[model samples]
Target: MTLRLLPLLMLAAATSPADAVPADDAPQPAFFEALRAADLRLATIAYRLTTANAALCDQLQPQIGMPIHALTQYAPAARKAAATTFRFGATIGVEAVVAGAPADRAGVRANDSIVEIDGKAQPALPGTDAPENAGARDAAEAAIANAPVAQPLRMTLLRDGQRVPVAIKPVAGCRSRFEILLGSGLDASADGSVVQIGEKFFEGYSDAEIAVIVSHELSHNILRHRARLDAVKINRGMLAEFGRNGRLIRETEDQADLLGIYLLANAGYDPMSAPKFWREKGGDIDGGLFRSRTHGSSKARAEALVAAARDIAATPTRPIIPAVLATRNVPLR
Candidate 1:
């Protein structure tokens, strides 16, 4: 994903588990519960990694790296099932995609089969020793920390009906590692630098749903909410600072939501997914207590985002600005 250029801001908010839930009508996946548990454990691991690797983290300043948590979606074992219908596999769950980094810009589409890694078939590895199945979550982290930067790695996958091979090279300076924490709530910062989701929300969501959360937080950074807030503070003067802060914060939050919809759609994610996710999760009641205190009430957020998306869809694209053409020195018209 392309980085959005925006200033950073320090905005703080508390979190609690309140509003996250799936619709009563939808069939709940057992694997999602396991994934949620894993996500919480991973968050603890990340907190430790941040502390233990402070120097390395500083060396990698302004660039964030986090493990790609593995998620499972049922795909057909045969070509026929690939054509039209599919079913969720038994024991659907998620694990950390050891050494998988989102900053690498490698697109791992939903439902893609992971057949081999580094020329070794996945099943060939020892059951307890494989990176994906290891008891320790840090196995993947250890692998990545030791690997040489910018080296190309091979990933063999099955896409659609054909087998394919792809090479991925990690990039430097990409910040923003994430993990889903337990509890229901939504929280975001001004610089769009971090996002934390409640474990309940994570369990009820698909990867696409999580992507919406990520993209929305990213939009906050892209739109420079922090800088805008600073400007607002300056113009308001010290006397009104406390009084105006609340309203200003609310406006920026709304704007980030609007911009987030566009960002997600541009990145090829489902634009409508956010609204649907919130709606099923209990649209903004009592400031989404079942969700997060930082997020707006569920009904308000869902309604506002849906309206914003409609406007975005109806709006026409703007033409790109061009660079100046080089000119010969001697010619005068």
Candidate 2:
């Protein structure tokens, strides 16, 4: 078999899991740059996935159209870091712009400093007394995301030290928005309409691998796995604090893996990458509750992914759900 699943999975399974770092915990200013970079890449991949399957997203969530393609500057310590190599002062610049997304189409480019939105000057940073530019940047993001459907937002940007005006036209997409949490855990998860990825994921995984990870987490939201588990009255708390309901937990993991293959394929990514990522990257991720608890063994999960991809590839129509497993439900290990 071309699948190299066992090696990485075994390595990851054996490593100790790290506790999740709270976002409020402040790190050094130098770390913000990496967090910002990770946010850009993760957002780009997520935009591709969500927009590629807009129809499926609509089916998944009726309110499928709030957040468009745009990323804010990660400038938590912008004021404090001005004395460093970065001389931009407290100005927050654009970190990512999805190709052909509203912001990109509106003439916004990476590194452009957002100055004003809808003719209103931005507010001060959350922790600084310096003029409201930092707060304004955040306000600009909310402005774009919450803009009325079919309405265009007028924004003023400081690009190359010149004031440039742009118009961003918002479009509908899956209701979920993408976010990156700066921490040292290799994990990603979705809650309601939001898909959040850990910053460490970017340092550890390739773009294709990241896509597979995001697709799997996104699958959970699309399939409403969390809601379904709640509906079924699964005692997630007991399993976390007390003991094990390992089988049932593994069932959900299995279902997400199977569905994620279709999502990867539908988004024009290599379905085979799913298995490859597992083989090479799985071992670095099993931590905290992810430590040898509920998930299926690395080999079993990778084999199932390979099998599912093969079945999907043998079909003619682009299926939202694979045929061989359409009537089946894959449970967690």
Candidate 3:
């Protein structure tokens, strides 16, 4: 799956953008326009965070700075629009290449159909294409991730019916992939290597506010919360919010909340925006099932963020790596 997670807000299935808009399923040019806009915004923010804080991560990825879309991401009926808009064949297309990223620097352009990666031919996504095409997209990333981090990826693009060759020499960044689940719930999650967020947030949040949420998820990975929780063997079932399970879960959330603000500042974002987001949107967005004992209240989180930002502002350290990062080697309290 796409691995879009909201640590304490419960898990929701990842849905494709095309799958989410069944009613407006017609092939309007605006469909891809809006999707690309959101994708680019998230990509830009993620690029900033991962690169600025690479010193904090133990693992690294060849940050290619591109988002690819598989034909399978669109429903059967919606594939034509994608094919036309992106010039699809039996291959995936470049959704967007982050400016100055490896892909963009190598002359890769949007809508370019990728036919091969490092001399290995990439076939079209299997079957008629399903909404859950994240695995297929991830496979393509695996091809790159498998390559040596210090080397560049030699790729062949079918542009104007000509097989074009290019090399994307990726830079070392935090080992993380950022993805957006189209028409997904109010959820954001971070696995060790991937950060997934719901596109719905674009409607409710500005790019800065969205950065707050994205930074929070990235913090979860930076802190290695999932692996730690798993190793400790905490009960993560429906009853995760009770007893020691609840305490540990909440601890992770608190750690993420604090470090997330630091990450924002490290990335050149306004750290106070973290507190501003929780103060304004927290009470509204975090209501209903989104609320959890594993997370602090909106008022509490915002206040805490305010205090944290004050500390970050006063400190003269660059990047300001979290001190708790060292304690992660010890067992959770």
Candidate 4:
């Protein structure tokens, strides 16, 4: 998840007014402006990369026919509570599983709750631990890697409120990677390699809310917004100038929000929750004029996402255009 820093207003209030420095000296404004520009550049690059990668995936989708290793964890009790109140609570745990590969065709759903792995009860890990923790998703991936090749592996899960058992065979010639970064704020590359979530803003969010955040970021990658931005930047020589075209930035942001809503819906998440999540997070209602360079006002983002969600909800089964993939690699991990 991307982490967004506390707004300057919030930060200023937290510290002594006497200690407050000018915007130019304080790293927030200028730094974020540069960061935002970098995000724009990266987005364009990612779009091109994803477009190429999608073609590869499509080709390999038939030949390798392997399930993409993916996992999600949800606590039923928590979900029920959230549904009742329309708010998500803390996550209980996540179940790591596979999707889109041969494993899934064997009846694996990413939603399956994992109780044990490799004949042992799964140990609980700290929810606050970084994604790289051994017992987190990485550990699950390793266990999957060590299983016997071509032989279905045993898995016990709670599906449909029943204790169901299943077997999954591993696939070769596939690799998985994720982008990670520090600091907080919600933003995605136009191309979609990285999604930033504001750490301070996540205070009251539930796992589902976080899912919306992740989905928004992932949407940028899927839609190739980043690559489009990069192409524009190259044509205008913005990289050399260390500047950006304001209109282009707004267009990309709007595009990301719209596409993000669709991605969230397709991924089976509540698209409406996205706007709700932002509203609860205090997103700018006035288009974030106070912090225009980094993000638009929480209110503006919420309103825009809500509209996009409405459009997406109305067309639930429509196929999305597969974005072209670029070859540029992501640097942050």
Candidate 5:
């Protein structure tokens, strides 16, 4: 029951069903399938963690887990394909309902345009100067994510050329938007507001593996590691994660690893899977956290995680938040 098997299985079904979805009328670009699939995987797992561990988060967001997009974000060749497939317009629209999320439970579906939320007109993209405009995507997301969590949201959706109204009771969740970047590299990062991983991660990894990495990234935000690091004034350049400067960064990584497994467990993912993911995939990653010198070796990292996970497994009560989270705002040494 802790694994929240129903939501995991929903995402495991992965992508749209073959029988229900119609073929693209216009030829889609070669990358469309891969891109959509990757985004869906990232979004689903992030939703699972954020919603499940809402009580542990300091910042809260309304629990609408589906991602949105504007047509402008797509390259010219791919715009038609994405818009037709995802039901986006010049303005922002729901990319997919992300089955098992609050939106899907409220009867929202892929391609539905968010006409209004709580009686205010949804934010609109002002222009399309760049065919591939990632900024537009970010802006659109900010618009949608602004929906408040204090009450049920009265949302109007554009479906089948009709304006359909639905009331979605908002579930308070950890405030962070999860996204996937378009690349083949093994990059994963978190700003205070967003968590991003390369498309490559979703392609080769299973749900459990993806859950481990994403929980780690989300841990950075939950702990306010970025703000704390900024206060400590550590170098972030190519050779930064070395010597004295890297020690603080290493501490943050270790904290993330410790807290991350708890998040994975709280979300009903097996805690031990964290060690397995890092032990198997850490060396294969060529950049980001693994590139740091003071950060433990993959073997060391896995061992540390295994120890922590075992402790949690041994506890009579499961899924307790790490006490270190209490010191999140204390200045890093």
Candidate 6:
């Protein structure tokens, strides 16, 4: 679930009026294309890395697949009307496709506008008066929902001014989804079903390093941390503000670090990158009071990851499960 750019807009509004650029000086379409490129690239990398540990995902996830690896771009009506070369219908266009995924294997290519599903034209999605780019996604989701697992889903893509028919066969996966949020801040979180990444996190990190962070968030989901904490009668509202009951949060963070290393190794990624990333970027955000409460020191996290890597190397054949905190029901640090 990629959040809209409302937060980015609000951040820009903080600058002085004189510092603000004119409305006409707003970003160009090519800028959006650049973001789209980066967004898709990172998403592709993440999808491949996470799905590499398909067996583990199969064990933990309830529903295996069907949310295929296809990133979408919804261009507005004004942009479509302004283009001189060719015009596109309000349908959504494919921004990226994970290699060897159902969509990729089915011959769907980037820039292809999804026109119809199973020979039926997609109905207009709610909340949009004008033609929308989400119609294709809505239709695709509906098609996948109705189609049985491993069954064929026929779709018509408008490519090169022609409707190219293709059939995609859905397969099983971990059920955890990935998305990129367009913003400058470096952050990511797993909202139960999806891992939402901020684009800023992509900068200054290699693909392997990014996988470490992603795996950590994915670990949170796998362990059902949010749900588990709630079940234990932990007051989430208290922890969200002023760092109350922060030791509990820190315990979860430690557990996530240990499990994240295992996840990285399971996915055939460099597990060592987990500690290295914490040593570098993780150190930059350490040392505030709130940070101490909500998260352990960077050094502590790196040390835990190091131990986790050693354990994984020692037992190469076994499946790694989420770690349980040593002490629970502790006072806030």
lDDT against the true structure, per candidate, is: 0.40, 0.57, 0.76, 0.42, 0.70, 0.57
Candidate 2, residues 1-333, lDDT tens digits: the string is 000011111223222344222344433444434444556677677766766665565332111122221111322333344223222322445555666666777777755655676777753223554432224444555565565545677777776568899877765545565666443356677765567776566665788998987887877777666776666566766473234455565666777788788888877888899988778777777554254666766667788899877886887565354542332233222
Q: What does candidate 1's lDDT look like per residue over 56-154, in tens digits?
A: 222232221233222111111211221122121111111223233442346544334445444544322122222222222233333334344457555
Ranking by lDDT: 3, 5, 2, 6, 4, 1
lDDT of candidate 5 over 279-299, digit per residue (tens): 788887735547747477788
Runs in model 3 lying further than 4 Å from the true structure: 1-26, 124-135, 288-290
Evaluation by TM-score, superior candidate among 3 and 5? 3
Candidate 3: C-alpha RMSD to true structure equals 4.5
TM-score of every candidate relative to the true structure: 0.43, 0.70, 0.87, 0.42, 0.85, 0.75
Per lDDT, the best of the predicted structures is: 3
Worst 10 residues of 5 by lDDT: 1-10
Estimate, for each residue in 222-249, the C-alpha lDDT of model 4 and write its tens digit: 5455666676653323332223555555
Clash tally for model 3: 2
Please name the candidate that would achieve the greatest TM-score relative to the true structure: 3
Please give the ranking of all candidate structures by TM-score, highest first, separated by commas.
Answer: 3, 5, 6, 2, 1, 4
Q: How would you encode candidate 3's per-residue C-alpha lDDT over 213-272 as one tens digit per residue? A: 999999889888888888889887888889899999889889989989988998899999
